[model samples]
Target chain A: MSITEQRPVISKLEQQELRRLLAENKRIDGRNPLQYRNISVQLGYVEKAEGSALVELGNTKVLAAVKVGIAVPFADTPNEGILIVNAELVPLASPVFEPGPPSEESISLSRYVDRSIRESKSIDLSSLCIVPGRSVYSLYVDLYILDYDGNLIDASVIASVNALGITKMPKYVVEGQAIKKTDEYFKLDLKDHPVSLTYAFLDDKYVVDPCLSEEYASDFTVSMTVKADDRFCAIQKNGGGMISPRRVIELLERSLELGKELRTVAYRQLAGGNG
Target chain B: MLRSNEQQQRQRPIVVPGEYVGDSKFHIPGLNVYRLSDRMLATTVGLVRIDGKRVDVVALKSFYQPKVGDLVVGIVKEPGTAGWTVDINSPFLAFLPLSEYPEKRIRLSRDSIGRILEAGTVLVGLIKDASIFSSPVITLKGKGLGVVSNGFLLSITASKVPRLIGKKGSMLSTIEKGANVKLTVGQNGRLIVHSEDLNVVMKVKEVIGMIEKESHVYGLTERVEALLAGRRP
Candidate 1:
């Protein structure tokens, strides 16, 4: 019932050691500044969900499930389907998380995923229209944090993208004024793959995919979602900190390279079923 | 006193809650076991341990239940008017009253108390009082108990604390000697590793990680010894 977000108490000794390691372009986990932890993707993890995926970014685990339902289209975009993203930081995921209303951290995490998918045109929303302005398929992406080690943004993004990619919906035909369900089913047409990369700034240096302890010791984190074509679709910054214009440019360049690598890894796992 | 059955002790099997463990007439309920009529059932998911006539379930994972006289490492939380709230990695937050502090003739103001132990400060203390009615109280009046100025904190499952310490502190001594570092272990499953060398600290962390993962398996001590000797197990 505790809604307050409890930040772990980090000791001065840890902070100093982390900073000292960062000064030498090293991390406590022995990774380089730009190196990400091991990533594993499991598609269709939930049998009941229309589409589901569980992604593990190091120790951080996020499960994304897609549920399709019929709803009236929005007035502004009648021809497009609705994509609703909701993220829940389950209490069992970490000691800090509690059972209550969704925290701001969770709300913002969902919004970041929503923006990345919407802006990147990952799903062909227009194809989901049964009757313009009357009825359309609404895809709901629900993210559950199973384990929280750190860098949840990246893990959630990967899970969402993979879940949406495998989503399948029943076919519907226009019958005069009403929409009728057909026996045939069709898979969602995925247009692009978007992957997010998060970096935590420690002192003057930054480390990609910071672990839980590093996150507590860090100043802030910047997350960027890049499309398959090397174009940025979404950018978000969390925590209280400042970043220089030059450093922003450097992060963007790194995002472009790492984004492709991540997409490949995600897709290869899904296709090979090696996860 | 009842004697231990070596054959039964060697075949310790995992059991779920409500599963029948043994007959009540022959076995006594202990730890996470309950006597349901004439049968003994497990009250939690854990490995069964039969010591003499006592049938106890060693839970694989559980929250730390604070007990009196337990040494604990806690982090300073909010500073209240009467005392400071401390998080001891348990379900309940412990209280550290100003009176319990070793210092005497101290100012009673909140500002003065905050100066002594600010939020986020890590300290080692002993649980002086614990009950279901109120939060546990920890006192820093004992020897080797006070503010910890240096050391890296690492947390593991509280249930695995015994495995990490091993028999008669044998595993702990082995780790300290192998890694060349000092460790302050808390009953609440928090550890403070003190070493100037970063590599030594990392080595200790790796050993702890190994213990946490392989605690349920047999031959853990030998594997830990192999790891400490810088050989792959």
Candidate 2:
């Protein structure tokens, strides 16, 4: 068994070569730095999921599914219901992802999206609990990284937001100890919407939603989650290199710009779904 | 007096947060706001609140969250010294310890915990508890909860689970009868079917696959049965 695998170290000479490519505003794959890979979002793709969506960004593909179940609240937080988010970077999705417990990267990926939804108050968590201290409904959002090209965080976030938008919870009526469910359903209450935008700093110039090739050449990655109200909900800085404060500002502005477009695309695709 | 009060209450609508009181539930799919009292305007997200006169609703959003006591299907990933970790598709990776395993027939060996639970093992477990510290912990000692091995992992839309299960296990019974495959369904879309005949298993898996895909259509059970019957003998 191998002791922990180390990420590839970029030599000084290689860094110079990548920087030179970026200075020219040209990607090794012939894409302009700001250009995103081709993206496609399919809604209601998983028939088993209450609300499901598949998002393909370049070669990277992710599927998100939403399910609801009855549950008891935590002892401390009995009044509030629960929302569970699970992210799986399947070994099939990428070779680097081992078939074991969720890596820190995958956990962080789930958290970034989870925080955005929670802070945005996308769903009324309190309403989910049926009996304050006793039982309640819990919403589970699971994201499967089926194919990994690069920028899974962004793809997963997009798929989840759209899937949640398309989600509908079964209606329940509580009579004494028995809980009765009706044939009715309701959508989530996403007060302030959140969408994630990722940028890979290839060479030195930043590229919007990098593909696998660009990710290979890039040294730093940034994921920015923006709310519908134009507020920054979450920001994750990845990659091995250090990001200068000036570069952070630049990426933030670019993320906002790109986030608006991504949100519109997600809404349109989800709205057009036959739910 | 009681009859007048009942009539008045009927005239007023039932209100909830995030729901909009419109002419009907189909008016808006998301949250809707209605005036309850002069100072109390509640919000609703699902269904409309209308009796006959006043209506109260907020918005209607899909309700799919996780809570305690849910029978979840999860993937086994990290095997640690303390326990084997499972990803129940939650914000946190649910952990299952070897100690929780029931005392059974397998010979005892003081080996590594990770060795006993290699990665990729699907587990049907109960949520024992969750901690805000790091991740959620799960238990496998309960009835109908154990290690899932040697089966094809199938997924369906989370919303379709109720439909697949039907009211009081009706839907699953029909699928089992038609496909002749023993299946264990997890609420999180992870399903496993076991059968001795490889061909029959494959056929049954396909039928389940179709059911999962076409569940939104009316008469899904009939369609699944027809597909199963049409398979080669």
Top candidate on TM-score is 1
lDDT (0 to 1) per candidate: 0.87, 0.69
lDDT of 2 by residue, B1-233 (tens): 12455445444344566333453333322224544333334464223444355543422222223456878887776777677778665446778876776655434456666667666566788877765665667888989988765554555655456666887988787778877778888766556666534456556656656655554444556666677778432
Q: What is the C-alpha RMSD of each candidate to the true structure, in Å?
A: 4.1, 22.6
Estimate, for each residue in A105-210, the C-alpha lDDT of model 2 and write its tens digit.
7888899889878876777788677888888888899999999988888888788888888888888888998888899988766555578888887645777777
Q: Give DockQ: model 1.
A: 0.52
Q: How well does chain A score by TM in each candidate?
A: 0.94, 0.88
lDDT of 1 by residue, B1-233 (tens): 23257534554588999999989999889999988899999999988888899988988888799999999999998788777999898989999998888888776643467788888888899999999999999999989999888777788888889888889999999998888788999999998988656678778888989987767666678778889899987
Docking class of 2: incorrect
- Model 2: DockQ vs. true structure: 0.01
Q: Candidate 1 clash total?
A: 0
Please list the residue runs of candidate 1 whose C-alpha ends up more than 4 Å from where it truly belongs after superposition. A1-4, A270-275, B1-11, B108-111
Q: In angstroms, what RMSD does candidate 2 have relative to the true structure?
A: 22.6
